[model samples]
Target chain A: MDLQYFAELFLGGLTRGSIYALIALGYTMVYGIIELINFAHGEIYMIGAFTGLIVATVLTFAGFPTLAVLVLASVAAVVYSSCYGYTMEKIAYKPLRGAPRLSALISAIGMSLFLQNYVLLAQTSDFLPFPSLVPDLPFWEPYAHIISSQEIVIISVTALVMILLNLLIKFTRMGKAMRATSQDREMAMLTGVDVNRVISLTFIIGSATAALGAVLIASHIGQINFYVGFIAGIKAFVAAVLGGIGSVPGAVVGALVLGWTESFFTGYISSDYEDVFAFIFLVVILIFKPSGILGRSETQKV
Target chain B: MASLIEIRKSFLVSIWFMFLTFPIMVIRVNTVENVIQWRWNNMIAVGLGSFLLSFVWRYLIRRKEQGVQRQEESTGLRRSIFQRIGEDRRIFLPGLTVAAVAVVVFPFLVSMYQVNIMTTAFMYIMLGLGLNIVVGVAGLLDLGYVAFYAVGAYTYALLNYHFGLSFWICLPIGAGLGAVFGILLGFPVLRLRGDYLAIVTLGFGEIIRLVLENWNEFSFGPSGIANIPRPGLFGVAFSLEAHSRYIYFIVVILAIFTIFMVNRLQNSRIGRAWLALREDEIACQAMGVDKTRTKLTAFALGATWAGLAGVVFAAKTTFINPASFTLWESINILCIVVLGGMGSITGVVLGALVLVLLPEYLRAFAEYRILTFGVVLVLMMVFRPGGIVSNVRRTYQFEGPDSGDK
Candidate 1:
């Protein structure tokens, strides 16, 4: 492939991978804290996308300027999704804290089904077109390939979110509490660190990141559906597992690798077999390194 | 002498009475619709026959319970009546007899639509039984088992469509392919336990489905293969001219054979090793059980059964699509094994029948069916975490012709 073509594919993969990384962080965070699979995490991603779409539409109808409306919609989506995530953890999962892993899994599946159907009932099942808020620039036209303005926005927004998340988790007291709770819930509770509050905060952070991802993805794709999260979620989950499910940096690395693999497969091989190629890569990786690429193997007690 | 004579007469009378009443009851129910059409003579005869049969059935059931209690008391076993009845071989006889009768008469009684539903239910039963061997017996949480089912289905479909092979000939081929895939899957993640293993298996299942969807040259892409051949018995076609009743009978025979094989496997030494692995994998390993071989065997055996079912399914539907084998299908089959009381053959069968028929029966509800189904599943999980028939233990007896040890 030519250098320009390679660069385009690389940029494309990076943008998609960033969104996946954001969602993967939620899965890994929740899993780290509770040892729960959090099957409804994908649905949370879906809710975030819908929330953004709704806010954007409402803002546009209110006669707001494009720039102002975009900013407000982004804020609304993140805040709403965080609250939704908090409530879900408190109500559905909290009661089953002491239950079997299988029971928790079943509950998560039930919640996922409930949320998906709820969306289907409330909104039309058709894919709604998401309006592009960013202005198109022609500077990249001279580079021998067309680059959409949305793609640059997606990459920048994702990077901004990731950097902000890293800073918050590294410096904030709430982040420390989250780290403590994840390491040892009972110990953290005994040490007077409000474990429940910490968990709620974790959900808030994860959900907000996922919402940001939703906005980016909606803008890039220009269309959203209730079922879009299903495939995206699975791919993100693959990313999470590839990077070692609970590791933050691992998720990012995993997402990039997955995104690149998918793009390369579609480019080199048939586009139809992209999904197959990705899954086969997952299986092969799991067989060779079950702990994931960057995951640490911990001893389990019977 | 008088007491002995009285006992013999009572036993003979009860057996003869039960035999005489069964057919009369069936005939009476059959004629009730005719009676509703202003047939006075038929109504009177049916009503009288129904009443007599009801009285006989009630009396016999009551007497059997009483006899069972007396026998339990006389046997001098310290177990309670419930325990004794569970342990008794005779209890299974009644259920088996009822199932046998239903299998025989079902095609005659139901429409072709209903028969088709039953056929699907039977296929699910086979799938559930296969899954039960892995998850239920061996206690391995395999979330990607649908991959093997897909392997079997696609193998049979592609081969039969391209090679024009007979459906029966493809059955073993499908099974072999499934077993091969099972071993391949089992080798990796052999050390992974619980959630990790489940995730890997889930990935494996997705991979298989994705491959089938993408491989257009071999699997015909999303359109899938159509007009597959059907299974025939000794060159006897199961076409309309040959009658669908014969096909129903054939499926019934397959179901019985599956049940019999499962039962035998459960009671054999291999079954014990499986139970051991389930109860404590470490201990089983320590006891020289060769955990790898056992685990692989479980996978292979389970996949093989699913493959056999796939062959039947392809022949029955005469069309195979990628949509037919999806992750949701795997989840549904797993739900059957879980709902049916894992490790319980009869429970799995009952679970399959209920889940398959419940949706059909709730057709009036339409959109609400899926919601209700999900709710029912959640409720069932909450109420009976171990499944409906989980606690029922089976005891096998080794009784030779000369050496009787009961």
Candidate 2:
């Protein structure tokens, strides 16, 4: 492939990877703490995107400044999705605490189905065009042909969020409590950490990040649908697992790898089997290294 | 934590929830007008409903605490009632016999439309029973079980379409292919367990569907193979109303056969090994159960029944498509097995009937049925993880004739 084409593909992959990274963070965080795949998380992201759409529409109609509109919509989306994340955990997952692993997983799946269909019933299933509210930055014109302003925004925003998240987890008290709880729940509780609060906080932050991702991705892709969550959720899950599921940085790296692989494969090969390639990669990775590239291999204690 | 009434805090949380839900639930885009519209009524309803839910939840918790004080008084009465049923055979055996007879004669008593619905329910029972072997008995959570059903269905469809094979001839062939595909998909993931296994199987299912959709020459792609021949006894075609009766009879027999085989397996050595594997993998391996062989057996056996159901399904519809076999179908069958009580034969039957019939009855609420199905799944898992009819573990006694104390 030519250099320009390859760079373009790389840029596309990076943008897509950032979106996946956003969703994968939620899965990894929830799994790290509870050891349960939060299957409904993707739905939270979808809901966030829709919320952002509505917020942006309202703000635009009110004739707000472009910058204010974007900022407010994003904030509104995050706040709304975080509440959904909290309510989801409270209603579907909280009651099943300490139950069999499968029971909780099943509950997550049920909640996922409930949310997806609920959205379908509440809103039109057809793809709705996302409002192009992103302001054009003059500095990006030189690289505009290779990388659009939107792509740069997605990438820069993702980097900022990841860095902030890293700082929050490392320096904050809630982060320490989350870390302690994930490592050993009972011990954390004994040490005066309210595990429940930590867990709820995890869901809130994880979901907020996902909402941020949804808004960025919806703007980038220019369309949104109710069923977007199912496939996107699964792929991000694949990214999480590929990067060693419980590790946060691993999720971001894995998502980038998945995105690049998909971009090149679609660019060079056929685009029809893009999803097939992603899933096949997941299965192959699972077979060779079930713990993932960066995951700590669990030793059977017997 | 110490307060009896935190009115301010509760009110704050409620208001916070109201704000969170307000944007998405209360306001929506009116596409024609291209403006955001307020759904104030929906906003108020949801806000009130959520507040009520929180209140009721606290009330239940309080009641549970108070009820604990009286539990000692009721324990004796509850124990006596349970023990009586445990020891009793007169009430159980006769009831089973009567229920069996009613099932056999049900089609004759019902109208054709009802029979058609009942037939569909029977197919689900077979699918649920088949999946029960993998998920319930063997303790492998297979999320791609519908793939096997698709294999069985396509096997029959292709055979009949290309080679003019009879349904009877194709039945066993489809089942054999189903087992082969089961083993094929089951092998790579044999080393994995729990969530990993579930995800891989899901991948395999998706791969199958994608291939079927893309490979136009072999499977006819999305348009699907139509006018597939039905299963017949000798040369008689079941293409009329009377033929519907025959189809119902065949389904009934197949369902019974599946239940019988599954029940037998549950009491056999294989069943014991599967149960052991489910409870603990390391312990079972240490005790001498061959892990790979046992798991493959469960997969192959489970796939066999799904294949059988697929053949029947193709015959009933007289058409086949990739759309007929989707992830939703797998979840539906899984729900039946779960709702009925995993590892419980009677529970599977009850689950199949209720899940299928309830949706059919609520025809007007068709779109809402799936929403309810999702709700039911979450509620069932949270409240009754064992299912509606939890299986009672049986113990055999090696006693002489005088041991018949009942």
Candidate 3:
């Protein structure tokens, strides 16, 4: 591959990886706290995309500037998805807290099906075009490659979100509570951490990040559908697993690796097997390193 | 006694309710015409059969309870012929006899569509039994089992298409490939347990599917290999042109053979080791059981069955595609095992029949069928978490010459 082509592939992989990392963070965070898979996380991402679409349309109709509309859409999508995530945890997941892992998993699957179908019923089954908010610029024309302005925006925005998330988790009281609850639910509860509230907060944070990802993805792809989350959800879960399910940095690295794997496979091999390549990578990684590249290995106590 | 009475009353109430609704439900079946009309009859037969089967099921329970009561009175412990049968007899003779009879007579009594469905159900039964060996018996959570099924199907398809191999020849080859993949998968995650193992298996399944899709040189990309040869008995092909009914019989025979083998295995020393591992791995290891070998054996055996089923599936369909071996398919087979009261052969068969045929029977519901199916699954889990026929409480009986000595 030429230098320019390699750079483009790397950039493309980085952008896709950033989105995966953001989504994987949500999965890892929720799992870290509750040991629940939160199978509906992908649906939440789907909901976020729709939320952004609707908000963007409304803002445009109201005669707002494109930048203002984008900001408004992002906020709306985040709020809307966070509420949905909170409700999911409260209604479907909370009652089954004391049940077996399998029971919770079944419920998660049920919730996922319910969301996917409910959305299918409400929205048209056909893919809807996402309105492009980014202005087409010729900044990368000199580099002899067609790189859209949207890609840069998505990558930077994702980075900003990750940095903000890291700061919040490291410094904030709510973040500390989340960390404590994840460490030991009983201990956290005993210490007046309000375990329920922390859990709700975690869902909100995860949902918000997923919403951000959805918006970025919608902008990149320029089309969205209800069923889009199913495969993407599986891929994101793969990313989380690759990154070590509960670690923030691990999710990012896993996502990048997955993205690079897909890009490389499509570039050198065939594009038809992009998804297949991602899954193969997951299996290989899982076999060699079950704890993930950066994840701490958990010891089982007899 | 109280619980038994409660169960009997509920069974009677459900049967009465079904009968009352039968006439109303009959109206929905009237829309289809000609050859399709047989489909309605099949539905009615299945419904009525299931209802009648419930009565026999209840009777067995009641008889076992009474026997237990007698044993308690005599031996000062709640044990009976039922317990003896459960503990001692490797084979569930009564249940197996019923299944065998159904397999034999189904082709004669049912329409081709129903027969085809029964064939599919049989395939699923094989898959579930294979899964039972791993998940239910050994207590290993495998989410990527479909990988082995894929391996078998792809291996058979490729070998047959490329080398002009017969379907019969490819069957064993497919199974061998599945076993190899199973061992490959088992080796790496041998140290992982529970969720971690499940995740790895899930990854493995996905990887296999991905390779099939991407490896265009061999798998022929998304457009899969078609017109694969069907299985033949002594050079006679089992197809629509040739005796189609005979094909159904073949499926029946294969299903019975699988059930018999699985039953035999479950009663053997290997099976005991598996159960021991499932109950408590550490304890099994402490008791001098080779945990690694036993776990690997479960994987290989389970994958072998799946592989056999996959080859059968490829032959029957005469076409194979990546879409056919999806995660959803894996989940569906898993659902059958779970619904059937995991570890119980009869329960798994019944579960497969219900799940596979329920959609066909409720064709009027169309799009809503899946919704209802999902609801039923959730309800089954909530109400009967142990499954419809969990044999945890059953007492084994001894009726042969060596009966009462123990």
**Best model per TM-score:** 2
- Runs with alpha carbons beyond 4 Å of true place in candidate 1: A135-147, B1-91, B237-245, B382-384, B391-406
Interface RMSD of 1: 16.7
Top DockQ hit? 2
Error of 3 at B274 (Å): 2.7
Tell me the number of clashing residue pairs for each predicted model. Answer: 0, 0, 13
Candidate 1 local lDDT, residue A287: 77
Candidate 2 segments whose C-alpha is farther than 4 A from its true place: B1-17, B59-88, B395-406
**lDDT by residue for model 2 (A115-234), tens:** 888778777678888888687789889988888898899899999999999998899998899899999999999999999999999899889999999998888788898888888898
Taken in order, the candidates have interface RMSDs of 16.7, 1.7, 10.7
Which pairs of residues clash in candidate 2, taking residues 3 or more apart in a chain or in different chains? none
Model 3 alpha-carbon drift over 4 Å, by segment: A58-64, A135-147, A264-273, B1-99, B235-243, B378-384, B390-406
Model 1 over residues B75-140: C-alpha lDDT tens digits? 543443434454677986785688689887888887887788888888889889999998888888
Local accuracy of candidate 2 as per-residue lDDT tens digits, B268-357: 999999999998899999999999999999999999999998888898899888898877788788888888888888888989999899
True C-alpha contacts between chains kept, each model in order: 0.21, 0.57, 0.24
Return the TM-score for each candidate structure.
Answer: 0.81, 0.93, 0.80
For candidate 3, the C-alpha RMSD (Å) to the true structure equals: 10.4
